[model samples]
Target: MKRAVIGTLLATLAMVAHASTPRDLESSAVVDGTLVLAKNGTVQTVQIKDEARYGKPIADMVRKAALQWLFYPVLREGQPVLAKIDMHVRVVLQKAPDGNYTARIKGATFGDMDAKSTDALSNAESNKRIAPRYPIDAARAGVQGTVYLALRIDRSGHVTDAVAEQVNLANIGPDSALRQFRDEMAKTTLAAARRWTYQVPTTGRLASQDHWTARVPVTYTLNDRGEANPDSVWRTYVPGPYTKAPWSDKSDMDSVDAVVNDDVRTEGAGPALLVSFHQG
Candidate 1:
């Protein structure tokens, strides 16, 4: 059974590795087009003259194609306003050297934000403004916690101010100790937050009320483990390779375990007695 299990594991790993590797397509078709949305929000047209063809009518192919275009309104005084946008789609067909087609599908662009021009603002300026008010001692012992702050970016291309929305360090023990750390960090971090800058749209004039909210995730790691060192406490307490087979019991083991040992403990079992029983 052990040999069979090992063989199965090796086979699964081989399959996963093979699946992860990139494969070349057998045939390819390149489709390119520009989609234009009118300012009135009533007229929409997609020009596919430059799009690739695969022996199908242009109108018929476009109608059946999975090409989509979206436009967000430029608001004015809490009212919807018109905005114009041009979108492009590309389809590539991959074919084998033996002259045989393998797959045919329409390709898509990266994303809205990716295509937009981002040279107006610098990330360093933004980071400097939003930098934490306090230096988190990530190397300190028993310092695992999350500090969440709400930041507002104004139209003037500046990180206005940051507020300590929430701080979670419950498992670190003792409220007073955690509060002291949180207060110090908040003070130092908030001071640096004033330096962060943002780039506003050059075309439109924004009112003082116009602002965007951003949430930052800060993680503190005291140690590292895993293949580097087996005796590391970080790796022991953290997640590791699964020793038990995923499909061994052929059942929802997690749900079954939750239902079985919710809060029911036998008086004599004690906390040390970890019962290993299977549930169908």
Candidate 2:
């Protein structure tokens, strides 16, 4: 049975790796978080470093998806050691007509943040945002996740420079399958983000700052997979001007489930748990 299980997993990994990598897609979700790795390579604890900029669901999704991920552990002298790693994941999510969404991991890279950089992004806002198009080929193959991008914004609120850093594909597959569609998704992400504009960063005094580095995350979700619809895997909730949030943010007593899963529920009107990363 162990052999069977390993073989099955390897087979799945190969299949996903062979799918087309995103080379032309234009939207992505850039996630910032930290995870504590156990000596055995399993995730011990995880946290999203920035939760203030986004709503609660975003962070919850990031952490929950993170808990299910397998990490490439830090080794010392050929032995694994307990390590804390800061990660910036670029995620891509596809949207559905109804707004309910599902996503897969796009890519993950190990890195940490500097205090100055985080402070600069704290006050920026989206002025003109563009979403990524669901890659037709990826959809046919049932690919989904949040695509992450790193951008430099000027005082004028224009995206001065943008780079397709990586996608947070922790959920895509345990192997190279995650790379298959990365380029396609990245192309879609850059094409859209280049046209986006943001509110210039400001001092607490409300003065405009010269420049800021921003992480742009685009998501693609699919609530259901339609074997018939190649893009049916692109399930995500994009709130329309006319709709309200599917989950409540205003209840006095919010109900939260697993700290790291999507099945979480909140009651009152407030942001979800978007906290900073620490030793936890």
RMSD of each: 21.4, 18.1
Give me the runs in candidate 1 sitting further than 4 Å from their true place: 1-139, 202-210, 224-280
TM-score (C-alpha) between model 2 and the true structure: 0.39
**Most accurate candidate by TM-score:** 2
Tens-place lDDT digits, model 1, residues 19-121: 3212321122223444443443332655554433434453345434422333343344656544333322222334466956444333232112223443122
Local accuracy of candidate 2 as per-residue lDDT tens digits, 61-107: 77887676665555556576887766655455554558555554454
Write down the RMSD of candidate 2 (Cα, Å): 18.1
What is the C-alpha local distance difference test score of each model?
A: 0.35, 0.48
Candidate 2, superposed: residue stretches over 4 Å from native: 1-129, 170-177, 202-208, 226-280
lDDT of residue 151 for candidate 1 = 55
